[model samples]
Target: MSSFFSRLKQGLSRSRDSLAQLVPGGSVDALSEEEWLDIEDGLIMADCGGELSGSLVQQARKRRGSSIEALKTSMLSMIPDAKEINTSENGPFVLLVVGVNGTGKTTTIGKLATMFGQQGKSVLVGAGDTFRAAAVDQLAVWVERAGADMVRQHDGADPASVAFDTVQRGVARNYDVVIVDTAGRVQTDRGLMDELAKVRRVISKAFPGAPHEVWQVVDGGTGQNAVVQVEKFREVAGTTGLIVTKLDGSGKGGIVLQLSHTYGLPIRYVGVGETLEDLMPFNAEAFITSLLPEHAVKS
Candidate 1:
């Protein structure tokens, strides 16, 4: 496998191993009601949604067998396929990122820009998070590190205006990618969400079918609250995909499965560590297998 895929496998293996230790395996046929409850509790503790955990356990009960292998296979199958980005387009690929404060939206943008730059694609960043001077400065640091171009207005400027000018520059300069970082706010803020939608509208108007991706960045450590955030953001900005941050810090990586199965939003990327190269593409099979017991892998 490619190095990226291999690193992803390694990171997910760590998470899965941690989860398996929380609920030791026994023959599926011999699982007592108490043991099943323990299994369900383990899934929830791992940040898996209760509904999803219940459903997975129900399916496993129906397919119960003498070996743990059968249970592992069934559990792995419960996870849906990971989503892939469509980089096939010609012009600058614009990604509009949204999320609440402390979700690592700015950091995620910087990492994404670095990844695109490594591919030799020219990138431009829009400091659309005009509400915070710190956010603007953070993105500027990323621009320097990634060696990508950037557009910014003074803090407190209209964010939509910043977005408009950024895309206009991208089209004129013919940059390969344009990433706009928006102000982080709770999804409950109707005015803020409307403003985000307005920014999307502005970008689409400038370049039809542009703002190609609306990615919501959620904190993996937020647990079930992340699911609520996804739903609210999707309704507001029409989020096409998700980038879950801080997976290394939280045992709640299982929220990914719930987000995918609940909202049908493909998890395009996951943040395992803080470095620019730490951001990796999501792989469903590898992630599922990582959650299995080490003995399960050998058997």
Candidate 2:
């Protein structure tokens, strides 16, 4: 397997280890109803969310028979599969990446650009976060690292105009992908959200049915608040997908389940570490299995 998958698997293993501590296995047959409630509490503490965890426990109780192994096997099947990207055709697959400030939105874009470029696709980045001079400079560093072209204007330029120019350039050059990096503002801010909508409209006008994907980047460390963030972004930007970052740092990674269940947005990718390759496509089974204790895996 690739190093990215290996790290993903490893990171998941840590999460599983944490989860195992919450759900101790005694023979379920020997446990009281109170014991089962304890197990459910563990799941909730893992950030699995009450609805999903409760549903899972109820299902497990109904189907209980022999080994904890069998129970875990069934439970693993409950998590949804990761979202897959269709990179089949060429000619400008545009991704509009957004997130709140300090959510590592620009860094995620840089990594994504590198990944696409490494796959032999031509990429053009749009510096659409015109409010911050640093945003443009940071993305420029990514452009250089990824060896992809960028569309940028001076600081304080209209972000929608930047997006317009970026899409125009993409169509003219027949670029394989155009990743637009937008400013990460609070989704509740009506003015900023309206501006984002304007950017989308500009892109659509330039290339109808374009802005092929609107991806929201959420910090995994933010816990349940990330869910609120996703909901707000979806309301404003009509997000089609999610990218959860900082999974390697905290035990709150269980928020992935909450995101999948609440938003029904497929997790396209996860940020595990700081390196470019740290980002990996989400794998639900591997992820859930990784959350199990080493002893559970062996048992």
Candidate 3:
């Protein structure tokens, strides 16, 4: 296996082991009613929502074949195909990223810069999360490591202004891509959500149709809560995609399925480890293979 796939398998070991223990050893045709229930329960235990787990179990039961193959088919059908970010616009491609605090939002931005840098694209990052001084400092460190430029203001400065400046600078400097980071706020805070909306508007004003994409970074280990974050952020920021993080050693990998089933938004990337290269572009086949037995697809 390639290094990324190997790391993904290792990262999902906990979730995979939990699922393997629940799957019946023999063929699906021989599965008892209790065994069918066991499969559903296992999915729930892995943080796939109860409704989705039931639906997947029902679909799998209808497909009579190898147990692992049938279950994998059911899951792959639920998740949409992975898609790359749209960066083909005329000027610099701008991306606005938002999420709750402690979800590794800033770290994800840093990794994004590194990824774009490796592509031979110049990256300019905006430290829009000005409420926290540490966030700015942390992003600065990541920007330098990635060899990317950044625009920031003092702590407590207007985040929208910072975003505006970043986009303006990106245009002026002719950077290939500009990524703007937002303050992590609770989903329930209407004021904060309004502020986030303003940031998006300012980015657009700075560059028409800018912020080509708004991606939300979510913690895979947060289970069902991740769903709520996506919903709220999508409402205010018009989130275009997702970047899931903290999957390493997090047995809750099934949350990815739940999110996909819930929103149907493209999963742009997944963070399986702490290293810069651990952020792998979403691969549907590889994800399923890592999370379950690598049985051939049943016709």
Score each candidate by Cα lDDT.
Answer: 0.79, 0.79, 0.88
> Can you rank all candidates by lDDT, best first?
3, 1, 2
182-210 per-residue lDDT for model 2 (tens digits):
88778778999899999999998988777
For lDDT, candidate 1 versus 3, the one ahead is 3
Name the regions of candidate 3 deviating beyond 4 angstroms: 293-299
Report how far off residue 65 is in candidate 2 (Å): 6.6
Model 2 earns a TM-score of: 0.90
In model 2, residue pairs whose N, Cα or C atoms come closer than 3 Å (at least 3 residues apart or on different chains), thus clashing, are 12-290, 16-291, 16-292
Estimated TM-score per prediction? 0.90, 0.90, 0.96
Tens-digit lDDT string for candidate 1 (50-91): 988887777777775532466456656765665466552767
- Report residue 127 deviation for candidate 2 (angstroms): 1.0
Q: Listing every candidate in turn, what is its Cα RMSD in Å to the true structure after a full C-alpha superposition?
A: 2.8, 2.7, 2.6
Model 3, 1-299: lDDT tens digits are 59888998988888888887787666788888988888888889888889999999899988977778888899999998756667746789999999999999999999999989999999999999998999999999999999999999988999999999999999989999999999997999999999999999999999998888999999999988999999989889998899999887577888988998789988888988888878888887788789884542232
User: Can you give the lDDT of residue 26 in candidate 1?
Assistant: 60
Total clashing residue pairs per candidate? Answer: 1, 3, 0
Residue clash pairs of candidate 1: 16-291
